[model samples]
Target chain A: MSETPASSVPRRVRDASEAEILDRLLPRYAAARGAEVGPGDDAAVMIQLGDRYVVTTDMMIHGPDFRWAWHTPFELGWKAAVTNLADVYAMGARPTGLVIALAATADTELTALEELADGLTAACARLAPGCAVVGGDLSVSDTFTIAITAFGDLEDRAPVLRSGARVGDVIALAGDAGRAAHGLDLLFAEGVDAAGVPNADATAALRAREPELVAAQLTPNPPIPAGIDAALAGATSMMDVSDGLALDASRIARASSVALDLDTAAFAAEPNLERALRGGEDHALLATFPATSTLPEPFRAIGVVRAGAGVLRDGAPLTGKLGWDPYTAWDGQLG
Target chain B: MSETPASSVPRRVRDASEAEILDRLLPRYAAARGAEVGPGDDAAVMIQLGDRYVVTTDMMIHGPDFRWAWHTPFELGWKAAVTNLADVYAMGARPTGLVIALAATADTELTALEELADGLTAACARLAPGCAVVGGDLSVSDTFTIAITAFGDLEDRAPVLRSGARVGDVIALAGDAGRAAHGLDLLFAEGVDAAGVPNADATAALRAREPELVAAQLTPNPPIPAGIDAALAGATSMMDVSDGLALDASRIARASSVALDLDTAAFAAEPNLERALRGGEDHALLATFPATSTLPEPFRAIGVVRAGAGVLRDGAPLTGKLGWDPYTAWDGQLG
Candidate 1:
């Protein structure tokens, strides 16, 4: 891989080396405010808010987390950024800038890295408008991996925490759910094809045609501002949807010491109720509101919090566990 | 390893399974942030700053970046947090939160993980006062690795960038340099002890005394607030010390379209000029200021930026032949 000269090849998506791709991607955010520094330095510097700031990070691995055959480099980059940004947004903070660390094989195609950068730039353009891809480390690893750390500002509004959920609060969702899971189901379930057709194509087409689901899988649109809106609207408890709603709601229930009774009927009209119940990677905003509070647009009531523990559907406990936990007996495959 | 009941053991550092150790560690953060969401949840919520946020991430691998015998889990954790937080702080922003991704062997001891968590907590307490350990993922891998993503708040200040350096700026250094390289030299060279004796017993005190060197190696103290101070002090160009000073300064010079000339006399006056020149992991701040700007306390003038390209010491170009760059044709073994 070292034998190939970086300049000899045309600048294709998968032909650029990590450094080459970074050079192309860093300049896109030249106009962003507070981006006193951009990518390529040891680290990027931004202005601080009051005395406090919000920070978070996440990593994406090759085999366990994603596969190159199913997703493009751009999609992978977008997903990586979205995953980290969602955490900040979940905190009810708006995301501003980013620093990315990449580990790739020495022989990996440079075009692939360029595609990844393109995906990253697309996500940053939307989620973190003026955010810069500041500093990062590059190394030749056995496998390809991308790690992202995101910085956010908490605009002085109180952070919406999970423990704030209370009995009698209405549970709501600000984005779609189960789409990514269904997309994965179509991708791995066999008999599904990329081209739109009938028969099993219904599931495959649903996975591909549904921009929400495909987008959910490839590049999650984290509702960072929506979270802030929810916080300002006095949201009691808030979070992002990376796991199934039941599993995530159970987390809130465990933290708030309250039972979460999800209304399956509320989502009965939507396809794939089981996926919605057991799906992951939606990157949606799930919050609990007091009975008297009014919800903003794009948010729909999905359930209610009760004075108990665990998650239930129509007052009955939804069994057949639906969530990903590292301790559980995982088959090393996505559900 | 799976046979051990992780729940029955004391939370203190104990040799147990990874599952058991994580079971203990995850609950603490959840309990500590009783008001915030627990770690078990998909994503955590933090407060938002303005309309946007800053983000960064890094990964530490076992073979390439770190070795098990050389560092305990606590030290590893501390290093991970420091590296990630340094990026945010280098952005002239304050860190707000963190999410850690850990990959290790199933046979890993629970106590090791506890120590790692303790290290992370210690660093967080010092560097990021109010930030939360928001969320993360853990998985079994062939080798041990830790990846950390850190988030920060750029309250409202302008971000400090690398492109702002200009000609005729005085180069300054805040914090020590080259200590880690010296420590590495001692550790790998003749098995000489790098860390000074703990002042516990005479038998353990036979090795060389290099407190500054060992501390630089084991735990790098990133100049967090100082980066911001440089920005406020009208620093024209700035960066953190990761690679050797020569290579990093060259980067600043190239970016700013200027040449940087080092005062060899001043460098030679330092206790360990070799370490200061070629050492890595100092985590110190290197900034360029107007020749007329007031020098901040504790900052040392080391070089000056002039009209041209590359870095020079005593009017001679430094090709980093003596500096650190992994790809350089240096033997793996240190001198």
Candidate 2:
């Protein structure tokens, strides 16, 4: 018989199960506060606050949004945690804890799960110190999927909303972009071999090594701490990089009754212009600062907020419309 | 052609779409707290605790646990929320918020999703007033699955745990038992269409009609308020019903160094004695009271805690197991 369609092939490796992933991931979160009972219990027990709590969740589906050929379980796990944690950080909060729900096929191997958990552990260790996984449920399904819910503590800071961006503010980006997009391009491009490569292998060593682009796609270092820093620095508005810059900038522009104009020349000077502009999954922090505020390090000046609507590049309209929107048709492939 | 095997049939409804289901469900949760940016937003937002928070999550998969024909979208949503909420409440906390992650075939209809959301909202309204549907992610998948994470506030009460039960205590249950098991029996025998016809019709006619068994199966009512009450009443140990009474009771016994002597005669008075002993999903509150403490109203005194090693039924050794265990060869069904 002819080979099955690539789309119909199960992308997940069978030997690494979700439980094995958790076993590798849970220990790193031992430092979280009020974690009387952590992972492995029926549920995790944490010290509860009398005040309100911030909560959010997200899911990563294979095939439709991600592919096993491009990403390892480790990278997928890390990216999933970052996506959820960044939302909490964008609200001007410190993540306290998280709960994960995973669904995989019965044949998934334990090692693959371990690698995914390692990615989750690495990400959580960076974003939420002392936070431990409390409880989760696992089941066998036709494809692999992960659902995560992150809880955060506002710590008395006012929440930062997309609508808070004001006119005449300076729009700045903190953290790198385009690396992930480049990485995705390299992974999906024909005649490339990612499986044979070693971890220490430099991006330049590979024929398609695009360091800046690949970094952005593979391990999105969400400026979570920087979001808090911006909030403390009196940022008026803030959000994370999920959709492309052009699309997300438009959202801020629409919310604040202002036109967001990006300096394209500045982006061009960067390593990869296309990746910096349209590249998504950067998890970078974009905030609006008033004219009076002094910009901090790593916070690059990208654009300005003016009295208008929609995003502009170098005073000209951006054509392709780069960014993430659920209703629209995405590339339907993961980096 | 001959009729297709049940396994070959699509799990989701062919006519209703996913988007349609979301449209209907979003409005029902319009009143939930922290729904500032509900379903349509990139990520939902809510107020965070000025301090700490408790979080937990669970996942339900088709085939391994549930069949589509046996449960409606509403029941699945409601039960998913209930299971997660019970974990939070078991820690002697009151639920404050929820996040859902869903995966279904693209062919699934919107009406089905709306029903699921309806079930979720209905359960939340009764269990956690003003709790928000903070955020979630959705995707099309080969199988139908759902994951839910719930958060809660302790409100100054100390969390009651399983480790606190001691000798010379009274074992009590607040809420009915075996109803879920009996409902499962009916469901397996007649399938969802014919199962609980009386209760289903009564629910349509009068909302107050107590479909104890059927309701137990569809949507378990975890005693959130009662958990707080138990903590306030100086309960030594407490937990929610998930595994059968015998197994869960044995857990308490092992943890508390007490032998539990359950009165079989008391359970025999109930219509479904076997179901009560082995059935799960009761979501009922089981707690141990000190000898000097007065039992609360509506709570049935089912057994006594004595210094010993394991669980007993009417002072006799249990010849057969009384609760469900994951390691065992279960028939692959939900309680």
Q: Give the C-alpha interface root-mean-square deviation per candidate.
A: 5.0, 4.0
Q: Cα deviation in Å at residue A151, candidate 1?
A: 4.1
Worst 10 residues of 1 chain A by lDDT: A190-199
RMSD to true structure for each model, in Å: 6.3, 6.9
Residue B14 lDDT in candidate 1: 24
User: CA lDDT of A135 in candidate 1?
Assistant: 59
Distance from true location, Cα of B161 in model 2, Å: 1.2
**Tens digits of per-residue lDDT for model 2 on B24-67?**
56677645564555554345555444233456787877765566
Residues A268-302, candidate 1, lDDT per residue (tens digit)? 87697888887888878889988888897677899
Could you tell me the lDDT of residue B28 within candidate 2? 70
**Candidate 2, residue B100: how far the Cα is off, in Å:** 1.4
Q: What does candidate 2 score on TM? A: 0.83
Could you give the DockQ of candidate 2?
0.36
**Model 1 CA lDDT for position B248:** 72
lDDT of each residue in A42-135, candidate 2, tens digit only: 4666654424345678788876556665567888888888988887777677777777788765556555776777787788887777654566
Candidate 1 lDDT (Cα, 0 to 1):
0.68
